[model samples]
Target: MKNMSLVIGLIAGMLFGGGLAYSGMADPARVRGFLDIFGHWDPTLAFVMFGALLPMAGAWQIQKLMKRPFADVQFSLPDTKKIDRKLVIGAILFGAGWGISGLCPGPGFAGIALNPAPALTFVAALLLGMVAHKFST
Candidate 1:
């Protein structure tokens, strides 16, 4: 069962990475163009986000109806409703990193197979940050 779960996860990750590359999301330049509202702006990212969200919204609704996930594992859901200092600071840091590098965690990993060097650096920094946060908290 654990092996099946791992296989499923691997397949899902491959599909996700392939989709990112195919959709041009793996390209930092494309992402930067999307973020640049004052410069040569591109709106394709907005459409991509919308397309992804539609199914996600439906999935959330379905998840609410389900007792457990398909894997029979307990659904780990967020219980927080309050917007606190940590959340605000985290959001700011995340936005700054995204704006600067044009590569968030998902895109960073997806880009590894395409452009390895920069992607590896970003992933390494990301993992370091995660470790730092773990130790700090």
Candidate 2:
């Protein structure tokens, strides 16, 4: 079971990496270009979002149709659907980080995992930020 899980994870990672490469999303330069709204205002990232979201929505719908829960484990989704204060604040923070850095957590780590210098620095800083948050809390 463990080996199967490792294999599945590896396969998933490879496909995800290939998708990033195909979409030109693994490059920080392209991400930066997308962030430069005042200068070039590239819509490439918007297309990327649409491309990613379409398949994701389909997968969610398919999963919903399944009678048996995932891996026979109880299906647990989010408890709250309300747009509360924390949700708003978290959204604002997420937007600000993406706006400033042009890379969210997944792509940021993917970039670093693929061996980019800028990605390494950003990921290191991100880890430090996480540690700081942990200690402060």
Identify the candidate with maximal TM-score: 1
Model 2 segments beyond 4 Å from truth? Answer: 1-6, 69-72, 113-115, 132-137
lDDT of 2 by residue, 96-128 (tens): 876677677767878876758867777887788
Q: Give the TM-score of candidate 1.
A: 0.93
* Worst 10-residue lDDT window, candidate 1: 68-77
Displacement of the residue 121 alpha carbon in candidate 1, Å: 1.0
Worst ten in a row by lDDT for model 2: 67-76
lDDT string, candidate 1, 1-137, tens digits = 67877887899898888888889998999999999999999998898899899889999999999988776477778898889999999999998888888899989998788899999999999999999999998
lDDT of 2 at 34: 86
TM-score of 2: 0.76
Model 2 clash tally? 0
